[model samples]
Target: MQPGQQPQPSGSYYPQQAEQYAVPPMIVPSQMPMMMPGQQYGQPPNVPQHMLRHGYIAATFGTYGETAYCAFLKCGLGQIPLMFSIPGCTGAYTVAQSVLPHLPYGWRAADGAPVILLDCIIDQTRGPVVPQEVWMPNSPRVYDQHVVRAVLRPPTFFVHTDGSVGLPLPQILSGNFAVNNANAPVDVGRSSIHLHIKIHGYTDRKRQFQTQESGQWIQLRRLVGHVGRAVDKYLREAEPDPEQPVPRLRIGAGGIVPADVVVVGVVHVSSGSWMPILQLTRALA
Candidate 1:
């Protein structure tokens, strides 16, 4: 099947004679509002609509360079958008639409001016549901300001999952998952079926608040270190230092500093009745 095309049942996940999975047609970008940076377009606040709150989690980062491989995510922006009918709710959710940031390597807030990128919209419905219109930020809720820090350095692009360059002692990657189905099927009485959903992606460089004198994009360095080092200091303090004679030295070789960069974590959503405890599976998966 094509990358975007939904896979037809070869009797794998579903029965061959059973009805093919229902997949909504793709929504054309043109029919939707023209999504461009600095362009004003969105639905009015007065319009009655279901609000979905979403958070981006980093899945993985392989390298650091001009063209590093990274992945960002778009989850349900509101509370669970879809649910299963079973007493324990269970089912699958295909991404219908999403709005993501067009972040590229080396793209910094200093070089990007206001540091605000375009709001990408992905409509995953069968047809156009709303008219195309430009958005004006007249209220706080409609266009909320999300101040994120670009804490990590530009990702180096030499790493791969194949263990080609000799696996690093510790593997660190960032990304998140979006699960629409939570409950289980109601008809399962004598049979046992398991469903495991895993979503992984690389973390992208986000814009910071700082700007260059020319009004171009410039990044703040301190923010980057904050996300990278804050945890280490916490761990050091928790460790038993036998040589420590002074009462918690504030200034020392290992000092705890807040990270400035926004370290995005790659998220995984795994669910099943006997799906090996959530914490254990995530640690190993």
Candidate 2:
């Protein structure tokens, strides 16, 4: 094939064009056609074009339509490993030749999901085309002198509602604020700052139950923003600011105090193919 002349289609992953191969199967390095030293391979090959030469390269999605594996190869040529993200999805693939060459051999996810390795190095003497984020604390933005230790202070209960007595229950939580009263409706103002919390137990008489009654504890998840709003709603009368302020929530007579406040997340993995060259580069890195 002449330079820049597109090769014939292998197959496609799309349902309508199902016969077209998006990415050709991986080729073992030992099986690759060997060229003798000083032989005319012409000039040093462009990685992406070299991928094109192989035929049936694959790709994943992005904000733009059907982005092929260009960036993956770029990372390989740069001797860097990177992750390719396709939003709202666990797997996706595209078709093209040579695109697979950038991927690594024997690449598989430790988590047993599909992944690709990209390994090729580009000459950086020409200057980097893109900059990576590097953390530098003393880089002209802020100058630091010495380290100092500040004593941890107790939670400040600034907003106390009238007609309600506030009792700071120190035994309930160490270095944290807790409010309790036998009767007069305790309004613990949500501190303006967000907090991480877990409800160890609660006492209720009429329901005749406590965290001890049921051995099982209910796990509650809360976001900082939502928790702030809930606190504002419950302690409405105690809010220091009235404009755009949320009220404190009132815990009902029979309602249970939340078990905990930390949020949990899940990661789902689906099966798919990734560029082998990209996979290889990542593995070596």
Candidate 3:
């Protein structure tokens, strides 16, 4: 079967994989989004999606260049929107969608810009559904922001199990392609994917405050950092060492076998913790 096509039973081999160089298909191959970066002739099988043993990833984001460009886009006047999310009680920690800045309303910041980590308490009684954004409880619960020094750079490319890029590792690149899969050479260096970020502070904790929620911010303010105070000045948080390397979030890292699933792992965030997650992009089950 061709790449992007419906997944088949395991131990399956396609002509291209078996042949060092495969002949063009009788018909053009379907351009499925599952196709990896260098994949021009064919795409990887969705079968591996199921075989993933590690936790899974749910979101897709652009490369570092995209991240930088997004940070500079101007709103109506001079404000740049800040983006971030909470990822609910349980879900893909969509690094790209969440972990953003530019909220307009809410607590002011300290000397530097605000880098708030609000672990908002959820009323599970409302069920297991929680929006990935900062879910503020309406009752009367205050949120605490734990600002950290660095954070994991979200992986834009397919990150393998060994923290390598390209060629899903566990896949036995059968036939001529075996070496390419085995060597797992880094066609693109890994440094671009591993990035760090600076956190800031915010002030004012009125129950109701305007948030920088609009992706299309028609009217923006001065895009400044290190210019505010901590949220709820009373809640004093221990200052973390900013000298440490920022942590990174690898959203989708898959491998071979049913146990080998796409996982969500954080590098350099306290004790490294990895969990099994589901891949929403490629159909596994």
Assess each prediction's global lDDT (C-alpha) against the native. 0.19, 0.21, 0.20
Tens digit of lDDT per residue, candidate 3, span 1-285? 332333222211111111222111111012223333454556542222211111122111111112211121111101112222321122111211112333222212333343322111111222111001111212211111110212222222223334222221123121111111222222111221211111112121221122233432211111000001111111133233344232121112341122222212211111111111112113222
For residues 1-285, what per-residue lDDT tens digits would candidate 2 score against the true structure? 344443332212111212222222333233333333344666543333333322112211111101233222222222222332222222111222233342322223444444432222221112111110111113222211110111111111111122111212221123232222112221111122122221111111111111111333211111112332332232232222333232121223222122211111100000111111111111110
Better candidate number, 1 or 3, judged by lDDT: 3
Q: Write the per-residue lDDT of candidate 1 for residues 1-285, one digit (tens) a residue.
A: 233443221212111222222212222323443333343567322110111111011101111100111111222222112211111111111122211223233112322322211111122221221111111123333222210111112111111223111111112112121211212112211122222111111111211222133433222222222222332333234333344333221212432222211122111111111000001001100
Prediction 2 global C-alpha lDDT: 0.21
Candidate 2 local Cα displacement, residue 159, angstroms: 54
TM-score of each: 0.18, 0.17, 0.18
lDDT of 1: 0.19
lDDT of 3: 0.20
Candidate 1 off by > 4 Å? 1-101, 105-143, 147-228, 238-285
Candidate 2 stretches with Cα past 4 Å from truth are 1-19, 34-42, 53-67, 70-285
